[model samples]
Target chain A: MEDTNSTIYALKTSAGQERNVARLLARKARTIDGIGISSILVPESLKGYILVESSTKIDLRNPDLKVQHLRGVVEGSVGITFDEVKRFLKPEPIISSIQKGSIVELISGPFKGERAKVVRIDESREEVVLELIEAAVPIPVTVKADQIRIIQKEAD
Target chain B: MKACTVCKMISSKDHCPSCGNPTSDNWSGLLIITDPEESRVAKELNIEIPGEYCLRVR
Candidate 1:
């Protein structure tokens, strides 16, 4: 289990500035203890926002000094913590808490909130094999378990 | 069933060979390793052989 104190955050930057801002944040975060910077995600749908993981709450009040410096290199940054990042980088469990063929809600992705059947479970990758609720195709969709919340458990 | 004296890698060959430790059947927890390249656990556990692995030993 991850420590509750360990925070995750996002640095919202201009479209093209993700790489530059990430490099700067990585350097800055290392200076502080109880702080860490993990992976960065730039979704195609999201125009801005570079997701980052930090061990502590980030002070974004001094935008000009605290974030603006990196913003200058990038554009702008909105400091967000780990919990906020979970809405983006949902880490799913390696094992299903429910039975197979059960319907689980999609927590994140294009099919958010949509319930799908568990077709398979990739234990190694921690991904869930899902069959879309209203799809004409029978292909099983593999989605990260973290990105979903189990709504109802199917009977064995 | 033997335990490696160095890294504790399990082998069934014989004569305390392959990892230089006497074989022991006292292993538990089956760790299924399919892909070692992308698996952080496999890399961290230093398992090159693709098969079941013993997670804990007494």
Candidate 2:
């Protein structure tokens, strides 16, 4: 059941109007016929451009697209792959200042006010696996990197 | 030593008390939400505890 309407295209909309245009496109797709639109995304890091995944190339002159004064895709660029947007879509860690063996305090989770040691770092999830040094059993818990404070450094 | 970029809670401890997001010394605008339930701005920002907070964290 492969669908022909599976290509992703880009649109040039006004900066900060991305969400609005996305909402409009979503609504139009639901009510219009042969819109062939599958999904729409407006990345925060990127402004003035919205990515639209659809089976067919959207017509800029289509009234349902609400392209009044809103820009559309450029010529010779009708399809884009995941790799094209991956660079801008990837998420970076919230707190990259942490180091291994550093003593950190659990500040917000169930183990609030408790201290722990950095056991491992999971940069992809922006989380850290910590060994609770203050606990009787020394439980290991994974939490957001920002959830723990570096109480002491390994050097000290 | 840092404050949460999301919740803006400041701490010598390095983590935010409200939200578990990262806290950084790279924050500006000091604030204290003692009554997150009563303070309009605190409620607006989703702060729910009495603690030192910063307005912006980079």
Candidate 2 residue A117 C-alpha distance from true site, Å: 22
User: Candidate 2: which stretches are off by over 4 Å?
Assistant: A1-5, A67-69, A87-90, A96-156, B1-58
Which residue pairs come into collision in candidate 1? A8-A81, A8-A82, A9-A80, A36-A55, A91-A146, A92-A145, A92-A146, B1-B24, B2-B23, B2-B24
Give the range where candidate 1 chain A is weakest over 10 consecutive residues by summed lDDT.
A85-94
DockQ of 2: 0.02
Q: DockQ for the candidate 1 complex? A: 0.03
Per-prediction DockQ, in order?
A: 0.03, 0.02
Interface RMSD, candidates in the order listed: 14.2, 17.2
lDDT, candidate 1, residue A122? Answer: 76
Using DockQ, give the best candidate's number.
1
Share of real interface contacts recovered by each model? Answer: 0.00, 0.00
